[model samples]
Target: MRVTRRRPEWRVTAIARDTYALEQKSPYAQCVDYLLVGRDRAAVIDTGLASRGALRSVVTALTDRPVDVWLTHGHADHIGHAGEFGAAYLHEADRPVQAAHSDPAFLKRLLREEMGAALAAVARPVVRRVTAIPPADYRWFGDDQVFDLGGREVTVVPVPGHTPGSVCYLDQATGGLFTGDSCCDWGVLLHLEFCLPPAVYLESARRLLGLQRAGAFRFNWPGHHGFPAAADLPEQYAACAESIADGSGVVRPRRHHAVVRYRDVLITLPRTYLAQPVGRR
Candidate 1:
């Protein structure tokens, strides 16, 4: 995993966590951590792979400002190791989803059936090493909520699509945007969670674009695909929506052709991943 540093005292570290597939193959999504340095307190946005302790070690390296863990969404890849932190915060709307994710058995089943058995192996350590973070400790973030972290103020921008209650953190001090999973591969593929329809997801993407237009932010960092330095994300999203509306986005071999019609806009398993088995299941 490569660790890249951002401008103005913020560093983004990509972890080496891989998920197992049903065919027992390993696939990596390049999870990221956004570490912010403030005069009073420091904050970490999104903890990567719980079992690996990536988030924990990163905090230890930075200043001991009262660390707060902020979740872009409650997807296992983003918040799987949330319990490891003293207290974490996420959008209140995703509370139920987070609750479901905290369940070991459910996660096990999810990996075994949906994701793949190979991923289950990697997930096991994360599940077993689970440290339960209290629900009360987590505060619900609203749209345009600003957290005053001493010298730095990280603004919470709600971009729900990939998941309900998904959020992104904007650091005004650095003009850096922490995009959960909304912008990937240069805003090509926008993955929608089951809770959100494809159309709704497009709307959320537009909201983020508006923020960028306002000129408060410039850089884009996602939960899985690392960082993107583009200013035309709004345009990309519009194109994605257009492909969905039209019939040009579909590809062969995959079943959800209509939903993921745009080759550039859909987030699907890479050929390297789908071709390989997840494990010895």
Candidate 2:
């Protein structure tokens, strides 16, 4: 039963000076993609999901300057239209598995994990309709690497826990950190097969905490729900990961996995738990 309906528009906003955000509210969760307009050219950060359709036309309406695409990580939701914009920069560490994350079976399992049994019956069919992950011209970079977008610069700070090549972009001009699946106040899953252990994740959290403490950035601009999340999410998440790493956090069973909570944040652990082999840092 295909329910035909209107396609949702990208909720556009000027998140910062010369920086625009196009947000897609997916059936299961919300996703955001950003466009940063620099003096010479513009860069699109992450591409949301393919369901949102091609973004180049939308971006062209925003700026006439040449454009570049950058992926914060390789998650299906984040890199959906990456190939639509030509070659994009992603950390080499994520190159191995990033391309295969968008297949229908993977999305089905992921939606099941996120939406749970309640919606699985109605959602699986929708997931199955998704086309294969598009092939991309990928240019990989490493941590602390800076991309000069003419006048402005964005540095990639690798956070491996979410995915081995997961990173947060520190926008030099506005002091905003474009953190993708990482450092979200909603829920952070460290249980994926490609994710690093809690101990490794904690290190990334600590780095964010330190960057926050030093005023490296003003807000944590996540790829999901809620823009500029609570000021102390990094701190709380650090403690949560720490508790899990040390086995002191109270863990509760949740469907296929368990979760450890710190305040309003929940860090889901893999069923294999801490026994999963560590990935490259």
Candidate with top TM-score is: 2
- Residue-level lDDT tens digits of model 1 in 94-185: 88767767778767776665556546676666566444433326777667688887777778888766667878888888777887776765
Assess every candidate by TM-score.
Answer: 0.74, 0.88
lDDT of 2 by residue, 1-281 (tens): 99998765577799889999889776644788899999998889988876645677788889988888889898877877777776788998897557557566766777777668888884554454346445667898988689888899988888888899999999979999999988886778887768777888899999999999999999788888888778899999999988887677877777778788998898988766644333311
lDDT, model 1 = 0.59
Q: How many backbone clashes does every candidate have?
A: 18, 0
**Backbone clash pairs in model 2 (N, Cα, C under 3 Å; residues 3+ apart or in different chains), count:** 0
CA lDDT of each prediction against the hidden true structure: 0.59, 0.80
Error of 1 at 3 (Å): 25
